[model samples]
Target: MFCNQCEQTAKGTGCTKVGVCGKQPDVAALQDLLIYALQGLSLVTAQARAKGVSDAAVNRFINEGVFSTLTNVDFDPARFQVLINEAVAHREAIKLRAGLTVDNPAATFTPAATLEGLVAQGEQHGISEALEAHEDLRSLKQILIYGLKGVAAYADHAAILGHEDESVYEFVQRALVKSLENLGVDELVGLCMECGQINLKAMELLDGGNTGTYGHPVPTEVPLGPKKGKAILVSGHDLKDLGLLLEQTAGKGISIYTHGEMLPCHGYPELKKHPHFHGHYGTAWQNQQKEFSEFPGAILMTTNCIQKPVESYKGNIFTTGLVGWPGVTHVGKDFSTVIEKALEMPGFAADEDKGSVLTGFARNAVLGVADKVIAAVKSGDIRHFFLVAGCDGAKPGRNYYTEFVEKVPQDCIVLTLACGKFRFFDKKLGDIGGIPRLLDIGQCNDAYSAIQIASALAGAFGCGVNDLPLSMVLSWYEQKAVAILLTLLSLGIKGIRLGPTLPAFITPTVLNVLVENFDIKPLTTPDEDLKAILG
Candidate 1:
């Protein structure tokens, strides 16, 4: 299985054996086939739309299927088999209804019952297909595909909150078909930028859904230590799951604590108001194996970034909403089993004093104090804005982000989002002109907030976003960051510093294209990069 859809792809190149994320060959093959089938579904749907017919069910399923293929989300080949068959059925249904002829191999191919047959089909439709094309064109195709994966993930989150944008779904289908065409490098590059543009709308929809449902996030202190009680540790980025668990566990002597991306949930008033909704429990998702095992409670994984469970804590693991492990219990919105397991486990013997970290500086929270921030910038109280954001990884060079944050000048302000903040979130960065020097934005999905805040700052300065005194220092580990990066490029925002490494899928020629077109580059030493930016 050759896969390089994530930051940790083996040796900064395609993973030809087991995935760096622990995905086995069979699972990788299945995911590729699933995407291939989904593309077939997209072709039929795109054709159907031309005949004034669109299937919302097919659109929702496409979003969900793409989200499941994201890193660390699902590894069960059995599950992918079911999704692939469903996509085939959906494709056929759409074609019959629209009276359109199915011309693509994906639309007419039948999956063999045996694993050998399935693997053969997947090999024909995998990234190797891109390899058969021109190098630059292949890179552009991969970029567009990865960006859509991010869009699907965010759009799924919004759909959970009863927020749906048909236009985003339509763009996804159109782009999928576009990527398969015999387009030139320039056309494919244009399509890649379009994916980024649509992602901005997708992020905005998710932001609206989250804030609309949970209320705007306010600056709140989330304890890093445990509280004394039975607890349910909720991880991943699904606020709906966390809210449901909070409601089910209320007054049951169980404390619901956030983990991973859920760390920013404390700043939302609606979630924070729960008397038993206690503090955070662990660090980023990468550290879950050690952290989850030590904690004496049930663990609910709501979405992606879930590692395969170790024996010690596997019994306590429960997954919901598209996250799955081979043997872990999968639940619906109802988390009764998770609550029961939490109650059955030994409660925290005593509370610790690990202090707290402040989060919830989403767009509204930051913009609410726009006047104060603007005054600080004008008076030179705040000299620079560094968006130290994106996914965190266990790789070596990741320490650059932590070190960079440490050495940032006292007068500068830091805006961070996603799990990357955990690297230096515990550090004591004080306030600047009444605003915290290090402002914690919401989750990775809250990249929308960062974009909004940057645009607002540019407006105040009477310049484009790139002309502001702000620079985006991002560390991407997965596809959501891909979509956000595309969104930035689509908006013509340049000078983004991305690390710990560039994607393995991007050939050097394609890398030069990104460097030339968007002015994107890899991170240098923290000191060197800082001097270059500040000088």
Candidate 2:
């Protein structure tokens, strides 16, 4: 069970025995098998689409099955088995519907009846075996596969809010089928770029879904402190789940606090309107073990970025949607059980006066003040902008981001999104004139908003985004960050500084291509990088 699909893979190589994300070997094998099943399903689905026969359920399942194999999304072997079985069923149905017969191993694959048999079969299809191609080709395939995982995640989120795009689904199936081919470097790279382009559309759909349903995020100050009441912490990036939970727990006296990526939800007008909606708790997902143990309430994880729950808070933690652990209680759309759990537990006994952080500086809120921002930049009051954003992990070099933000000059504005901002989110960076020096542009899911902000700013300045005075210093932890990076690169955004570590799956030859084509570089010390960017 070797896996190197994430930043924190064991020893920066591969997770051989157990996953760093607490995924057991059996669960790992099951996830591998699930992906194998999806490859087969994708084969059949691609054929069906060509024959003018497509199933919405199968298309949706393709995204779900792929998303489940992402880091920390689902860790239950039982769940993976269910998904595998469902994938086979979908494949068989699609084959029958399309009246086609394909002889590819993936197309004719069959799952074992028992869980042990499934795991054993999965072991044969692990990443090491599946990607046994040339070094460079394997790297490109890894990038493509990981990028697909990220696209599936965003697409799934958008579909949940009633936003659907057939092209996104079509591109997913086409790419999956292409992965099984003996494509060359140029062709595979073209597919990777296509993945980025499709991801842009998926993200646009997600942005519309979120802003259309909850209204554009407005500049709002959210308290980081506690409220005295029955409490429930909502984490991850699902706004709909949080909204539903807010509605159910509103009159029941439960104070809902946003955690991790959910912290940005406070800026959404529809969500913040709930009077009982409390402030944020905890930092990033990495610190959840310590933070969740300290929180005196029930916890709900809506999506990815879930860690192995500690014993202290394991019983109180409930998972919904795709997030799952072996023994933790899983709830559906109705969160009555989560509400009851919060009622049963002792919430915050007293209120605390911890200061608040400003959020909801998404595209709409930021663009709303475009006139002022443009004036400030024209007046030379603002020097440069730094889009310091990405995922945050517990790796050692993550302190680079913390120190980098602290050392950012007073004349520049720091635009941040995702959990990476947790490194220096609480800092009082003040503002350049009326604009805050630190602008929180919502969650990782809100990368589309950040891209829009940059594009709008570039348009106002009559220059390309690269010609603008902005540098992207990104830290990646999982596949979603990989997807976002591809999106940036596909847009011809260059000279980006990515660290704390490079992906192990990328060989030196492949890394040289990125360096030559895109000028992508590994992050150095904060002081050196700061001097280079500002100078």
- TM-score for each predicted model, relative to the true structure: 0.98, 0.99
Candidate with maximal TM-score:
2
The TM-score of candidate 1 is 0.98
> For residues 439-460, could you state the per-residue lDDT of candidate 2 as single tens digits?
9998887889989998999999
Spell out the clash pairs found in candidate 2. none
* TM-score of candidate 2 to 2 decimals: 0.99
Tell me the spans in candidate 1 whose CA falls farther than 4 Å from its real position. Answer: none
Clash tally, candidates in order: 0, 0
Instruction: For residue 486, give model 1's deviation from the true position in Å.
Output: 0.3
Instruction: Report residue 38 deviation for candidate 2 (angstroms).
Output: 0.7
Q: Give the CA lDDT, 0 to 100, for residue 371 in model 2.
A: 92
Best by lDDT: 2
Task: Give all candidates' CA lDDT scores.
Answer: 0.89, 0.92
* Global CA lDDT computed for model 1: 0.89
